[model samples]
Target: MKLKFSEGVFECIENPPQFFASLGNLHDATIISVARTAPGGVCFIIGDVFNNFVDFPEYPGEFGAAIILAGSTDCEWTVSASHLFGKKINDFEVFPAHSADAKYRLEIACHAMDRYVMNFDKAEIRIAR
Candidate 1:
């Protein structure tokens, strides 16, 4: 999968190894870290936000950390604001758009996916999908 950022940054890693290398750099640079789940799918990690991308059909919408990231391999890649959670680590603040503390939290999360943030509201991301 590929990621598109609002700052004109676009990245795509075709294999697991490449994904690892990119993730390593992001981690080392204190940028963002993401990993392809061993079983399947992908996960993005930030301070308390750990968002996992799952197939839409398995979970139609956000119920927690699990979210619909993409419709299909060839479909638009998307993320929902409602899907972010940090309860696993005891941080319960859901990523919000209007909060002074979270205005750019979504953008930070996107960096983990190799995507830069754009403006949007709850339950949806700005990325075209």
Candidate 2:
């Protein structure tokens, strides 16, 4: 699927599982499966580590990590990360591209995260966000 986030573009491929974020390369990524971390706290993780395999930094290689975001049932959103290099990986406040409902569907969560991540990492290339 091709997703547009503001001025950024991302090509998401399920095969081999990667998201290409207009960095002139493709990242070997893993979109962490959706899971409920706490009561009413639904989230999806995306980072370099996938299926117990850790992605190492490689020169000339595409980015292997990403920032994750999510909207609460009330439409309030947050941003966090597994690995962000110099940037803080801890959870922080953010605004979703669209309003979220009580349904809490996986597709909606992934789409919201993708939209936020693409814009956040637009200038970041081949780096673990």
Candidate 3:
């Protein structure tokens, strides 16, 4: 199954929440695949990290991730990696495109003790299949 994010909305590609045991916490190690839509939206393909693990704050257990899209002028977004599981991973916020006709850059800001990590990804709006 896949989780899709587009046009400020999130939904599962296939199957339902019952397919997974539970949504794990954030801060867990996970890989997310992002795709750019034609109309300026973003699609994320999040896969499982473990085969039988579930819940948050448990090491080596498999859990999903949460994506919080923020429109911050300060150039940072926050993600709670420790609270991922049984929930949709796609989160989005509206932002200005780099250019009038170009795709919008989705900025991610992860907060740490002293500083933050800034990452940029772009997306377009479209229907999910």
Candidate 4:
């Protein structure tokens, strides 16, 4: 998947070996780190995982996963299985319309699974303006 940035500063990495052993069927995992390019942009970190499957004689097309992140805003973002498994790790530097000091929040919605796991050791966020 492709992550759109507001400005001309953004970067991405797919399944870094330091964090995960292999992408395997878990292709939907991503580590998104954002930085502030201008004075009005904010930076944050997002880690997500998604999985879909079917149970014999029980459930079909069942899905489960978890989302995790850290930042300074309170806005909510939706995540889907396709976006998680289909996209790559996207890191970016953005320039928002608001001030850099503005409130920022990160929300992670964990699906079918009871919990979502994130290895912060392999993920981070930095802001410079």
Number of the predicted model whose TM-score against the real structure is largest? 3
Give the top-scoring candidate (lDDT).
3
Candidate 1, which segments miss by more than 4 Å at Cα?
A: 1-31, 48-72, 75-129
lDDT of each: 0.27, 0.29, 0.32, 0.29
lDDT per residue as tens, model 4, 1-118: 2112122233332223322222222333333443432323333333332221122233222122222222334332354333433334322222221435432222233333312222
Q: In candidate 4, which residue pairs get closer than 3 Å at backbone N, Cα or C atoms, i.e. clash?
A: 1-87, 11-91, 28-84, 28-85, 72-104, 72-105, 73-104, 73-105, 74-105
Candidate 2 is scored at a TM of: 0.24
Model 4 TM-score? 0.21
Query: Once superposed on the true structure, which residue ranges of model 2 sit more than 4 Å away at CA?
Result: 1-27, 47-71, 74-129
What is the descending TM-score order? Answer: 3, 2, 4, 1
The clash number for model 3 is: 19
Candidate 3 regions exceeding 4 Å error are 1-26, 49-129
Score every model by TM-score: 0.19, 0.24, 0.26, 0.21
Ranking by lDDT: 3, 2, 4, 1
**Residue 87 shift from truth in candidate 1, angstroms:** 22
Candidate 4 Cα errors over 4 Å, as ranges: 1-71, 80-87, 97-129
